[model samples]
Target: MESAIRITRETEFYQGYIRFKMAVTNESPYAVNEVTLDFVYDDELLRVDRYEPLYVEKKGKLHLGSIDGGKSKSIAVYFDPQMCSKGTDIECNVAYKDYKGKRYIVQMEPKEISVICPIFRTVSDINTGRLKEILERLPHSESCVFEVLSSFDMFKLVNLSREVIEKRNVKHVRTLYTKDKTNYELWYYGKTKVNDDNIVIKLSFLAVQHTVELFAATQTAEALTGLLADVGKDLKVTIESRVTGKGRFNLHLINSKITGNTINNLLDQCNMDGTCDVNIVIDNINERTNAGRSSVNNTNFLNEQEEQRLEAEKQALIKIEQEKQESLQKEKAEKELLRKREEERLRKQREELGRIQAAEEPKRKEEEYARLKKEKERQEQLQKEKAEKELLRQREEEWLKKQKEKLEQIKTAEEAKIKQNEAQARLRMEQEMQERLQKEKAKQELLHKREKEKAEKQLKNKNASTCQKINSNNSKSNNKMLMFVVVFGILVLIVFFAIIPAASSSEQKAIDESVKGDNYYNQGNYDSALQAYDNAIELDVDNSTYYHSKGTALCGLGRYDESLDSYNKALDLDENYTAAWTGKGYALNELSRYDEALVAFDKAIEINSMDAQAWSGKSEALFKLGKYEEAQAAAEDALDVRSFG
Candidate 1:
């Protein structure tokens, strides 16, 4: 059968709880709506306590809203494994509804681990779906019988269960009667034996829990005496080899050889002190010795004859029981037929009476319906008017409230802009004042140099008389003065040509490029802004502001990886730049590196506690990391910062 929806489950174990992850996929061509999953499991074994996500869990039902065709959705449910029933296996069913409100159910196989006896498992640990493989292997070798008696009807028994009906095997099957009521003892025995000497596996249903019993015929038990011990009339053997790993034991007999996985399964079903006796049967232990070979052969031949007689008697009993059930069923069918005929006669009588009454009451019924309809229409009109008035009033109130909030936000933003503009104006005034002072100092130095040149030219024109006289009078003092003047002039020329011009051209041009990038960014031209910022960086590679602006432009282009590089460069230049820190956090979040994003956001907040962008980015990171409450708090902080900071 094709399913309308497909469900898969995975389980995870934690310190004190269990996590069950369930995914529901829609397989149909049309969408499924109102897809709610109602969990059904043994309440004694597990309780659906809470969720790993999808905050709402009510009475074990989860509302998944809607699923589009070919789409899948998943949820994780937490469980507390505490048992009230000792030998119960943990299984679950999910009931869900389709678009038309029709319900369907799906069953999940039991887990390998139990609540109280977690280390142990039975044939029940095998997924019910895989039981067919084990059963199909039984026919060629029905000489070995396997029976699993589980109270769960979920085993899908019709896949192939055959009755042995042999007197020898049926006698060993568990009794059908227990307590006051009858408990089903699902029994099956082997058919034609291919090789009676070899072992075979079997599965038949029986009780609330599952157990597998294996049987085989041995001609001479002496050959396999070392395999088991006979204590009294009961066979008792204890085999315990430690399984190396965790998880369910693999007991499916794909090969004839028994491995550690198979032994581990048997060990799980063993009783306290580690003894497993319920599974094995050896038929002819006493007849294996040669001393009693003739006597045992006579006894076995007679026993076979007697077994034939008993099998005939059991078949007779089954035939008698089938005849009894058929007789009862025939009687029941006659009674049902008679009752249904009587009901049909009564229904015809009622219909005849109804027709007669309807023919006589048409006018009165029509008048009453017309009057009722008029009254209903009047009431509906009044309701419509009242509803319209209420809706209008609500809309007016909501509109006024929204307008007030919008105006407040606008006012705050305008105030912030005004303060920024005022700061820029003060900065411009300072720059102009410094430029004027530099110009005044340069003008005085130029005038001093020209006057020195004029004085030297006039002295040269004195026909070398004054020059020779001064040189003759004070040659040593004159040389010292001349040397000092020449040195001072060279120093002034170097300052004018080297330091001031470099500051005015290279560094100033870089600042101009950075400002242009900011303008382009404000205009939402991210490509142009990025180009301008790159030009600025080429001119002044050490400036933090250029890198910060470049990061913003890269973010605008949705290039988060490169944006992260830019933000990191900015941070390396100025570790205390709050905007760079915030931008780095935002880029990290876009890259889905949430933990590192939180650190960046925290650092930004530490530098400037009122950074709304930092708070908002922190909120998003926390939400992605599954810290819902912390995310909510950070979101509220961001809102408050934006509204009033």
Candidate 2:
């Protein structure tokens, strides 16, 4: 049944958008009902679009209604991409029901699609370590977010970033307090060229630290989604993910990307926290776009002097924090030592007390042994309870991990489904286009055949009925018709081939010399070409083409004066010889005779208006004369004539 339905997909690109056309056709004996195509789309990269002959039933799905046997329907849909992306799959499901009430879904093979963006490069994942190392060493303030920078001064770009932040609605802020606190800026930039479907871009992003407080707030998951939701509020974000054994902190930023569940991989390894959360896609501030520290200005949009002042302040603060951390470590170590000493002292006292009891109550030895056994059981029970709590915590962490994996799987599935409907629509449209073309071709052929038959009938007006013809004369007419066919074939062969003429021996020699000169000229052997053309001129001095050939050969040899003489001689033989006139113009131009060149070129143009060489020569002559406007017009004429030809 699937074989009974045929589909084809066609893709086209325009200046601002891409189009996918689909054609769905039924080759079955019976009609199908309620045919539908469904798929998912990433809103961030492409926006949903509609053109003529295409109507959507709903988002991510198209209701095709019904497909009759031997019928085809087509539609075109468009995509306007906002950012570059690594390739993602969008699966399509084609489901339909037969008149008999049986439903079927057509499965299609996966297909590869290509997209081209001028300046942006698409990457699957980012390596944050390298990006962070580069950013931390920036000489400027952290608030100087760069949007696009190679074309402008650094401060100006930073000013623009600051302006965006000021005008922007801060919307919401959510921070995760992690044990690790070394946060680095991330970005991408480019100077690139994408050829065909192959995209190549190079550039890094620049951003400020104003967006994050680093480790200040203890934001619950409820307060977190506001920013993530805005990321692709109008459209769905496309994600490129990988499976790793190194996953930690459900939402911690480990990979260059920060898609997290427990910690949603948003921050780097040092930013790890013991928790779970969803994810968001953040990139470098880049050509078009990135600060924050403790007790620091939220907006580090400072001037050079201010930046220096801030840096000095930051260094002082950093030193103080380091000393504070060292003191805390020392205090912790001393406390651990003191606790161990106290435990040893308590153990000694217990032993002494136990010995004293043994001597004082020798009869109570059985009671003492039972009491010791009970104490051992109590300690063992406490250990068992501690182990169970540890195991439970491990299970909870595992559960969070499983949930994150499930979400990723769901996203992957949805991605495939979205593209499925889009591809399906494209296939249906292609089928319709092909059918229209075929019908048009057949119609034209039939019209041609009918016209040909009409002409034949009009020419042969003496209509003799076969029944009225004598049977005895049929053999004679057949013999006559056969003879006519043979005669006609011979005439056709002669007519088609009669252009071949037998030249006299001297004329043939002249042509051979001219051909030899042409081959030499093509090979850039101007000295040899000149000799051959001279021989041809001696053999057939009256031929204008030979003189023109001699002129070109002389021109090639830097003999402009001689070339001019030869051109004049060719023109003398035939005044309307356009090539000789053009050659004369070229020779005159080379000699800096702009007036003479213009006259010669004009003469050539008068004889043949479509002569591009003459137009080009005229343009050069006018340009030499400083008639800029006239030269431009002549140049334009040459281009127009060549394009038509």
lDDT of each: 0.54, 0.52
Please write out the lDDT profile of model 2 over residues 408-492, one tens digit for every residue: 3432432233224323543464455457656755765675576557545643532333335556777668756855765575576
Assess the local accuracy of residue 440 in candidate 2 as a C-alpha lDDT between 0 and 100: 55
Q: Which window of ten consecutive residues has the lowest lDDT sum in model 1?
A: 231-240
Model 2, CA-based lDDT: 0.52
Give one digit per residue, the lDDT tens place, for model 1 in 1-645.
Answer: 356788888776542345678788889877777666766455534656567666355675677777888898888776654321233334445555565444555655655443321111121122212322333332222111122321322212211122222222221221122232212222222222323332222323333433323332222222112111111001101000111233212222111221211222222333333233455221232223366456433221135765476466447645754685577567656755765696577557656865765675576567778988999999999999999999999997896566445434543453344335433743574477458657955975786688668657655654464455563547757666766776677678666656655665776677677677767876879999899999999998998877887998998899999999999999999999988898889789889999999999999999988877677778778877878678768867877887776
Model 2: worst 10 consecutive residues (lDDT sum): 234-243
Best by TM-score: 1
What candidate 1 gets wrong by more than 4 Å, as runs, is 1-497, 626-628
Q: How accurate locally is residue 539 in candidate 2, as Cα lDDT from 0 to 100?
A: 89
Best by lDDT: 1
Query: What's the distance in Å from true for residue 69, model 1?
Result: 39
